[model samples]
Target: MTDEISHPITMDKRVDLALAGAVVATGLLAIWMAHDFRIGKFPDPLTSRGVPYIAGGALVAGGALLAFRRLSGWRDLPGHLTVSEGTEDEAGHPASSLRAFAIMACAFVWAALLVPAGYLIATPLCLCGMMWAMRVRAPLRLIGFPVGFTLITWVIFAQMLNVLLPLGPLAPLARRLGLMY
Candidate 1:
């Protein structure tokens, strides 16, 4: 005789539901806030409110999709995977949770350093540190990801969007590096 206990629900599904609920709520709030917006005298057909409304609508639609998938049990998970009971390791040494803590610390450090060092310097350091902590094997990727992220953020904020980013004491250095004006 074989007895099997089945759990009708999964933690993954619960997480999805929670995320969906939050996103939907946030979208609704965005839409509500958007209603109060008024573009002045000579407003374009696409006003300041247009992008926010579109983004909020997209978020709402995505949240609805996630909620529907969870309710319908249409999960894109592998069937071969099985959950193992207990938390003890084979060698009896507890696995380190410090890695997660380290990542969070790195993010906090990056945020703290952002204004002083600017995003160009702080972001790449954070990305490299995170990749190292995560034990990424590809050496090229270790260098590439950080540099790519920094360049993209720089381009988007400083050039394309024309948003002023503080260069801190390195304003001249950044200008010499041809990244900032």
Candidate 2:
């Protein structure tokens, strides 16, 4: 009875291992690429090579950790799988592959529109579309979350990272509004 009650949820270990392997491979590639990064007389610490090295290292470390956790926890793994994590699927309707595909389609649309439609418009639409596909019923979250997330992303990318994302038509408006800083 206790054995049945304490059975741990599990996914295939090979999947995680493969993902981790890919991450490690990517990290190795990053390190290799960083070796040839040309340095000038003066360059910011993260501008030349630090960002890629940090990102690739983090990915490799995180993937390794996930792979290790998944592999170690495989003994009590389920014979079959449905949801990947937690008991979210136990509430009657389980996770759907169709929904995942729809969300991926939304991402592709957002990427497609990013250059032409501008960040403010394309990001919010993508978020809303994904939320709709995921069946979010709350109106506030459906509306507010995307705007908030997009603004946060914009601040980080534009102000902190100094990335010049294409503003498209909003370029003039933002310029007039003194928002391009």
Candidate 3:
């Protein structure tokens, strides 16, 4: 006979339902907030807040689908996708929640530093920190990946699309380098 797995704490059905419900509720709030957006003074046809509305819509649809799937028994979750606080290693140590918290904290740190450091500097540093935290051991990537990602973003957004990425403290330097408006 085959066994059905159960993890009451983190992988419970009720927990998944609650999470999906929260996502759906948050998405609805996002949609409601987006309705209050006002057109900016720019001549551009697309309003500043237009993308938020689209994102809110996607969140709503995705959350609804998640709720439906979670509430239904039509599908079975693969082993790796299930969360279990009880899982133990050969040393009998439980899985670390520290990694998840560190990743989330890094995002908050990135956002806090973003305005002061600007896209050119902040993004690369944030990417490097995040990669390191995720245990990406490649030295070349640790150095080169952030630079490549930042340059690609700069080219696509600033150079090709003429979008004004936040220059922050690098405004003058970027202007001198012909990388920013």
Candidate 4:
């Protein structure tokens, strides 16, 4: 016989329950806030409240499923949920919480800069920063992907949807290029 230790319920397993609880709480909060939104004067099929309700409902459903799976000791949970912190990613790099923190910081900075710096300037920088934090080293991909994605989104919002986007200091250049009317 060999010496062995067994942990029927580990701290890592508890983490799933904690995360599920947080998600459920957030969803409930979102639904409550969305319920308070004033109805627009114009009668639109999809109001401002529609998207939030849908998102909140989805969150609640997903969290409930996750919690149920954990409580029932389901063996077929997703790989990411089972993988503990500091585990090696598919690329062989040890996943770092520092990288996650960096990405969050980048997102906060992007939101702070959005109105002043404009979407074109702010979004690419945020995407590049996030990619860098995730260990993307290729110069072409680092530069091209963010720029391309931003431009595509800008066209969709500004031109297709007829939604106004801040041009910031690029207002004159945009007008000259006929990007804005």
Candidate 5:
């Protein structure tokens, strides 16, 4: 018998293809929806629809590339896929699908609470939850990373981009602290 192992069609391939298709479809939908945006009265280098168009196009290109790679049997790809690598966790134990589900659930909760709880409150909680799900037990990292990240993003969007993020009950305090105008 030959020492070389055979790689057959597998469920993982199907799942990857399906995800790629979904990304492409989502991109197409974004492009379609962006076309319907109302024209602004003010003249600007980048219009309201520009970002969506760019983002959608990037998604389409990336998804198409991934699909092509998958269809072409990952030719010239650097690494070889092994069953042990895909199935095991960092500790060499069987990976738990529950972690993935928890992360997804956290994201959904974050989205749901974003408007009501505001970015500062909702985002940190979501980040902490995801970190916990990922088995990060350090107290400093769990608190510091999320808070720092949220503040940085808040400044970027609110101050630099001049985009308004819902402050919810923090509006008064933020105004007092000059965090928002």
Candidate 6:
């Protein structure tokens, strides 16, 4: 019997791949711009460019993997089933490009405003806005998502990672919470 292949990517899949590539490329570009490209001699036995080089290489590899999986016959290689028509239960939903755009926009705005508003305020606001925009209508989740995410992010980055996020107006409150202890 002859085997047939079908398109592995829906419109949503294509959008996802493009977004991933854009993000990875942006990170790689940032690393390239911030550090010297030359691997100079170092007392620690590693150059300043070492970390960036590894990050850039990983970014490239990730983007290539996504692109290759989307555009090649790799989907059909090895164990695979023949193409078939969609059944009633297998109907696909329309891709929500608008939601994707909104989510990305929210993230950008959050990052841009983080230093100004502080992590405590900006993070919760961002999470709530993003969740609502993504059509999460449950009352509990609408409230819980932002609060939970903000607390977790604060604990992880501020407490554990030792990264100083802007405290803004919430500095007093955070101090009162005795987070430092």
Worst 10 residues of 3 by lDDT: 78-87
Per-candidate RMSD, Å: 7.9, 5.1, 6.1, 5.8, 5.6, 7.1
lDDT of 5 by residue, 73-135 (tens): 744333443122133247755567999999999999999999999988999999999999989
lDDT of each residue in 1-181, candidate 1, tens digit only: 8897654333555666788989988888898898889876785886878877988898899999878866666445444222332444568555657878878988999999889988778888898888887877697899898989888988888889988877667798878997677
lDDT of 3 by residue, 1-181 (tens): 8897766434666677678788878878887887888877888665866777778778888888987976665246543234554544558544557866877887888788777877788888888888887788798999799999999989898899998878797798878987765
Worst 10 residues of 5 by lDDT: 80-89
* TM per prediction: 0.53, 0.61, 0.66, 0.75, 0.67, 0.59
Candidate 4: tens digits of C-alpha lDDT, residues 81-109: 44343423668677799999999999999
Best by TM-score: 4
Model 4 worst lDDT run, 10 consecutive residues: 78-87
Model 2 scores worst on lDDT over the 10 consecutive residues at 1-10
For residue 50, model 6's alpha carbon misses the true position, in angstroms, by 3.5
Which predicted model would earn the best lDDT?
4
**1-181 per-residue lDDT for model 6 (tens digits):** 8886564432444564686688579667857764856665656554776677677778777877776765574355343333332533334655577888998999999998888888888888888889988788998899898999889988898999988888777787878997642
In model 1, the runs with Cα more than 4 Å from the true position are 1-18, 34-44, 68-112, 137-163, 174-181
- The window of 10 residues in a row where model 6 has the poorest summed lDDT is 81-90
What ranges in model 2 sit over 4 Å off? 1-16, 33-43, 61-88, 148-165, 176-181
- The global C-alpha lDDT for each of the candidates, from Candidate 1 onward, is 0.78, 0.82, 0.77, 0.85, 0.84, 0.73
* RMSD of candidate 5 to true structure, Å: 5.6
Candidate 2 residue lDDT tens string, 27-111: 8788779878887668686767887788878878887887787667666545543225544466777889999999999999999
Q: Count the clashes in each prediction.
A: 0, 0, 0, 0, 0, 0
Ranking by TM-score: 4, 5, 3, 2, 6, 1
In candidate 4, how many Å is residue 8 off? 10
| lDDT of model 1 at position 127 | 87
Off by over 4 Å in 4: 1-11, 73-88, 176-178
